[model samples]
Target: MKNLPQKVRSKKLSSRVDLTAMVSVSFLLIIFFMVAAELRKPKVMDLSLPYYDPKWDNIITCSIGVDNRIITVLLDDNNRIVTYSGLLFYPIESPKILSYGKNGIRKELEKRRKNILEYSASMGKPKNGPIIIIKPSKKSNFKNLVDILDEMAITKIDTYAIVNDFTPEEEKLLASK
Candidate 1:
């Protein structure tokens, strides 16, 4: 009996667990988890620029200056500092007069339209930053402020400086001039 190998052949085959299907299931699960964990919400908030020197003579710009203190402006789609009518203001104050029309903002946008277009084409920047500034004395009249703002908006100046104080850097530049 021992020498005669048992001829008992099993008819039932072992259940072969196909791991390929399991692997596919695991991949699907991983993808599900990865997609579920990703964030898809849009966020919103204020995106104003950094205001340099928030405190000072409180620049109140107008279209024209009564005295010769008003800096001469040049506009050729590159330097839009002012127009003939409205005024623009930062650190918002009740202007005695305004050059930019009421509720008109983004003054610098008009002035540097040429530079902005060139820069946008070459550097991929959508708009150029205007570097114009007005340093009116604290006692400057409202009409002047109105006139300057009017000119500023017409020219398209989004960013400007109000000389409240001559920082050391400015003093050095002025002293050299």
Candidate 2:
């Protein structure tokens, strides 16, 4: 018999892949996205709503006399704002429709603040500035309320209240418009 070479056999290698690096990379990506989402969170504005007392049967009441220190801002539909200093019936300044921005409500607020400060000084009263009351009618939208609140902040008003209860007179006035 002629000499024959034996058949050479090739070694079989395992086909399993190493997934350690891939899993680690996926975890890192997940963490990065979570951190990014947290960093991109929206800003929030702090608002203080009026506190109610159960003891008081009538929460909304008219001032006994006209208070020059108080300013009432009524938010109506169609982006209309009615502002008056003191009582609506006996306002120091008559109610007028005002729009938003520097030329509109902002100007009026600044002017009123100046006038109120001057009046307080003249009367030998404390310079506590004017108290603003914001009333949003049912017809009004949330954006108007937010705009008004932003105005309050821009004007550096420290004292303000959001009163949803509209006076009958205010309702009538809004209805007239």
Best by lDDT: 2
- Per-residue lDDT for 137 in model 1? 38
Q: Please provide, for model 2 over 104-175, each residue's C-alpha lDDT reduced to its tens digit, 9 standing for 90 to 100.
A: 999999998888788867766555578899999899999999999999999988889999898799898888
TM-score each candidate. 0.31, 0.62
Instruction: Please report how far candidate 2 places residue 21 from its true position, in Å.
Output: 59
CA lDDT, candidate 1, residue 132: 49
- In model 2, the runs with Cα more than 4 Å from the true position are 1-66
Summarize candidate 1's per-residue lDDT along 1-177 as a digit string, tens digits: 469777998799889876998999999999988877775556576233433343435543332221111222212111222222122222121222223333333333353345545644565434534444564433345565566666566765655555555345333333332
All candidates' lDDT scores? 0.42, 0.84
Error of 1 at 160 (Å): 3.4
